[model samples]
Target: AQTVTQSQPEMSVQEAETVTLSCTYDTSESDYYLFWYKQPPSRQMILVIRQEAYKQQNATENRFSVNFQKAAKSFSLKISDSQLGDAAMYFCAYRDTYSGGGADGLTFGKGTHLIIQP
Candidate 1:
């Protein structure tokens, strides 16, 4: 069984600054996938970024990027130039490649509540 862990239960960052959320996972399978999702107050699960185990390069999007350490099973999300809209609950998720498929629900961490300071 694979599990995702988010050490920090809550995080705060100043607007226009940057914050990095830490995430770690345990998995026996060499080929898997990691994802970071954002759930705002609206309660919608949005895909922030995803990384494939087989890919050596980390995944990045706009102001969001991942620091993936395959050997250590660590995948962190870095948000640059954060904005007030960025405030939300960030969840780290894991999916086994060999598992069912796309229809299978993702295994998610508790989540990190991001607070934005004015």
Candidate 2:
């Protein structure tokens, strides 16, 4: 079984600035995928980025990137050039590829509320 944790309950950043959201996971399985999802006021879970455990390089998308510390089991999200639209609830999710349950094997953390200040 895997569990994800977000230590910070909330984070605030100014527009055009950069902010990093911390995430950590505990898992006995070696093959898995890490993901950062953003849920806005509309309640849509948007995929921000994803990182595969076997990959040595961290994943990046546009202004979003991840600092993946495999051995330490840490995956943090960095949002650069933040915008007002970036404000949302961010969740860290884990999917065990070895589980064979597909999307059903996903485990998520309690989200962190991100607030963008103008």
Model 2 C-alpha lDDT per residue in residues 39-65, reported as the tens digit of each score: 998999999999999999999999999
lDDT of 1 by residue, 43-62 (tens): 99999999999999999999
Q: Could you estimate the TM-score for every candidate?
A: 0.95, 0.95
Tell me model 1's lDDT, rounded to 2 decimals: 0.95
* Candidate 1 accuracy as TM-score: 0.95
